[model samples]
Target: MVIEFDAELWLWEARRDDSWTFVSLPVEESEEIREMAGGQRHGFGSVRVRVTVGSSTWTTSIFPDSTRNCYVLPIKRAVRRAEDLEAGDVASMTVELVDI
Candidate 1:
């Protein structure tokens, strides 16, 4: 199944020595995905997903964010350039839950 939404890209540093940028799935969207998954998840509560942003499409996983109580989509450096995405820039995204 395919899920679509819009969200702002943001930077996150899970570790002090490392940093990554991510796009968070809205609560409504995340809940929908969880319901569809039926409790299937990998480590860190990550749900495998195929993501599309702008002109790029790739496979990745969305990790749960307890603070926000939502899921976050990591945007790779290559994808950021291809999509011309920047932190704080709102982007229209499509996420397809994988291994369902």
Candidate 2:
């Protein structure tokens, strides 16, 4: 799945405790990825993907946890890269993290 963000809004506010706080950090619209892998019951699958922005490349993953019955993937590095990339996007490699 590839999530494209037009822009990210970062809002800050001052707290009553004499500290500054982040009010909002909005990310671009999210995209969904769906795939089925062969396994018994309790298994996991992970794929290493590469996200490219301009000339930079970041490694990422898609993890499916069978025990939890859910698939989750974090784009933390991609989000951070958004800071430097506005006209950039991501590309990924397909691989299995685990098979049981």
Which candidate leads the pack in TM-score?
1
Indicate the residue-level lDDT of 79 in model 2: 45
lDDT of 2 by residue, 1-100 (tens): 3443222222223334212211110122111233323333232445454544345445655455343343444435344454442213333322233331
lDDT by residue for model 1 (1-100), tens: 7888888877886533214888888898788777877768888888999998888999989988988888898988888888777788998989998888
Could you tell me the TM-score of candidate 2?
0.28
Q: Which candidate achieves the best lDDT against the true structure?
A: 1
Give the RMSD in angstroms, all C-alphas superposed, for model 2: 10.2
Lowest-lDDT window of 10 residues in candidate 1?
A: 10-19
| Model 1 steric clash pairs | none
Task: Quote the lDDT for 87 in model 1.
Answer: 84
Error of 1 at 18 (Å): 9.1
Candidate 2 error regions (>4 Å)? 1-43, 65-72, 77-100
